[model samples]
Target: MAYSADGTRLFSCGTSKDGESYIVEWNESEGAVKRTYQGFHKRSLGVVQFDTTKNRYLAAGDDFSIKFWDMDNVQLLTAIDGDGGLQASPRIRFNKEGSLLAVSGNENVIKVMANSDGLRLLHTFENVSSESSKPAINSLAAAAAATSAAADRSANVVSIQAMNGDARNMVDVKPVITEESNDKSKIWKLTEVSEPSQCRSLRLPENLRVAKISRLIFTNSGNAILALASNAIHLLWKWQRNERNATGKATASLPPQQWQPASGILMTNDAAENNPEEAVPCFALSKNDSYVMSASGGKISLFNMMTFKTMATFMPPPPAATFLAFHPQDNNIIAIGMDDSTIQIYNVRVDEVKSKLKGHSKRITGLAFSNVLNVLVSSGADAQLCVWNTDGWEKQRSKVLPLPQGRPNTAPSDTRVQFHQDQAHFLVVHETQLAIYETTKLECMKQWPVRESSAPITHATFSCDSQLVYASFMDATICVFSSANLRLRCRVNPSAYLPASLSNSNVHPLVIAAHPQEPNMFAVGLSDGGVHIFEPVESEGKWGVAPPAENGSANGAVATPSVGASASEQPQR
Candidate 1:
């Protein structure tokens, strides 16, 4: 046992009557043990020494090795030496500066070690078996006996040789007490580390916090993520070459690429004004994915996807652009929906507004082009869907969307319509319901309404293979359904995955994007500027099997019919 320099706390290490070894810290003022350190050694310990220089380290010796510890964390740092390396009466001592240590386990042999790091042997003297002195065979034999007797026992217990009246044992040497033992000195300590209230405050950097994530989309190759923040874009790239492994699978040897402050053009059109409310700004990707166009601040800016640099800026006449869509066959053609209930056809190659067509009676909320049917579909706040011919720009058919039955009518701003991979059918997300419709007849094929008790839908998307449908809710919950039958697959609760800084924040998934190549991968943008990626874990081929929470589900995510699922399907929470 040893008292700290301040004498307020004591560090002790020794063997119990049962031969169980222990190391502990004692708070003398309260007359109670402060902490017990376990799982470092197995045999009884020699005297514990405190480093006077830093007062943040402690070290001790068992029969065969020296153990170093960090007083700050009260945890073992390292243990060094060989079997029966220090025979009989192992004693440890440190120099004035505590940078060097002297340890003796045998009368004839002494070890000089460096304490700069974990105790490293610097020099060895004529200790026991050294050639310069007569080998003390008895001491070596006794140490071997003690070690062999404690086989498979606790490692924290240092094997102490039974007293046999032999001076060759460690009991022969005595610890030399320092002059500081009798002298009192001023104490310097930090809170929780020093006694007598001699505490100091420390300066630390500000903690990082989550920002609101406005939109999320996958790059054309599905190898990267474009996290559209309120005013910037954060890129998360999963780079992979054409290389494959022995199993003929793409080798995932490279870590994903990420940016710190994101790209240089951190400011976007939304930066023009500060709007605290949550809204999905209009953005479009060209057919070839070479460029991205964003509509905000009463104008539209075209950006090169690879460079993220503005290529051109267009100020729409009068009404601001609210939604945008690129023609599926031509990268130069763009269809911009405006607040004036009109669709403006623009030819970027010629830098001109080819034409303007009026159909919707209200502002357009969503627009999508169908390459298979060669037509354009647009939805508006009037709860109407209109189909138009691409060649002549004429309205063909229109249908009224069903009103939100169980919740508030959010169709005006929240309505979303997307075409499936086959382009023969489409999915419409409006209010609290998600419905699949046939593009030919524009009739509803299937529908799933959110439970009234659950949060409203914020964003939804299909899996890469179009076999699964995912819907993100305002509560940070996600429900996956089988696209074929519309039956619930499983529900996901991502709030658990939020960083500690965002755990309690009023955040939820605002948008979701699926990986184009990896069916098991997807990214969800949170209401706060945070992105949660659901990636496939190669070890188990299944998602995390967390402790049951909602209802009785085993995991909190929407993936698939787990290709390796052996357990029963997770129930709804």
Candidate 2:
């Protein structure tokens, strides 16, 4: 059973009717049956969820197959038939972007389906249990304890415990005794570690572990196909990338895909380093992408991106750093946004906070600096955009964001800023709208109302050359506009592209990074943890003949695997 996105409706699977499983939707506030979805299942349904972004649809999976119901039409949209690896109902999940749907029942396998093209099958992957984790004491934990011990007092023996996922099996750990100490509890050195003590390990059933992929990401290059399972990032060759689509067609000749041994990354942050309750990892990359910064409820760590070796660790006191950014001109100068509504200017060169700027009444959501403008602009969930004079870190001015055009009654939130290449003009996003602002005037030069057509607007940015503006909605819709006039040049949705098969996908682009060299080229991050390269395809100009305008003018783009994709990954332009 689950509540609707707005929390006003509740849906649940109940007894079968006429030998078919049925779903009842209840008015959340009054607990009354508002509607029922029927005629889809013959078995007991295990899971039910709503995807209201693009389709007013509710998805449910039973023992034999998974089904979808269009709540808007009160009709069955699609019924996918399969055992779904289940003796019972399968778990169902939709990616936040609402384009990808995952269903799993009993085994390690999961089926991924795309909602864009009549619920076509895109891929299937192995699912692993994230619930169960083994705790092995690390040298980093001993070192962490040693730093505090040495600062307080010198002791021959130190007691430590294995730090696991909040279970904290307290084992009285003594360092290894090289030459037998007078007391057995006394230690010589913390050279090796042991597993947690006196705790029963429980393994979850394979069926229970079914459900979802926790995250998505890119691998070493576009050539590799990576799969994530049980905290491991596996470079899978059997279930390959750009190799074969699930197609949902069965062939008797093909051998079953076999699992292979996989590689993993070292623990980036030890459990001992941060408060588990508040240990949310925050990450930022330096301007050159040479260094990586991470903070997880504790000290901030600056590490080498390639080697993943810790270069430095410094504590940013109380309230924690919610967001981090590097100075455009000086990477060493870090802008740390605090949870308690403050921004600290930390200078790595001198190893001290340069200044603390306070103006926002809430945590900072975005941070951008302009050495050319000699100022820094910050936006916060408190609906405040504050400017700070970088010279002395003085608050210059503050502005409360305006509510959306039709949402005057509801206060707006989630403001962000991005300075144009010139550093004179910047993009400001607040609520369901984006505007251009200049440093001196602080006036909205141009503004456009971003609609919640797909899902709520998630992100927006200016082109590399600052000629185009890009805004992405959560439901896989990307819009491009001319910054000069705010005219919509192109709008790309699930049905936007040619080669009909490619237009509908299981993933939608949410996060984007503009290419450093190409003004019309950028990499868009998909909700499924993959990346797609978007670049403008231009026709050869001997007499100035442009590509078809329907393909989105000269700035029109096609999506493909980025960072050196092979021939197959490159789509036909």
Top of the candidates by TM-score:
1
Please, what is the TM-score per model? 0.54, 0.47
Taking the candidates one at a time, how many backbone clashes does each contain?
23, 2
* Model 2: pairs clashing at backbone N, Cα or C within 3 Å: 216-529, 217-529
Instruction: For candidate 2, report its TM-score.
Output: 0.47
Worst 10 residues of 2 by lDDT: 190-199
Q: Give the TM-score of candidate 1.
A: 0.54
lDDT of each residue in 373-466, candidate 1, tens digit only: 6778888877778888888988888898776465345436557788876567887876456778887688888776655555677878877667
Name the lDDT of candidate 2.
0.49
What tens-digit string does per-residue lDDT give for candidate 2 at 1-573?
A: 444443345565544322345677755334356887766545444323333333356776665655666664467665554323433566666665555555554545554443322122111110111222322223223322432343344232222111111221111112322222222222211111011111111111121121122212222122111222222122121222223533211111122232232333332432224354443334566543346566655677776544456788886456676667787546678998877888989898789988888898877777888655678999887867788887788888877766545565334356778898656778886546667777766667776654434255556777656777766665565655567655454545444321244345545554554533234544454444443444433331111111123233224342321111011111111
lDDT of 1: 0.56
Candidate 2 residue-wise lDDT at 249: 16
Total clashing pairs in model 1: 23
Provide the overall lDDT of each model, using Cα atoms, as 2-decimal numbers. Answer: 0.56, 0.49
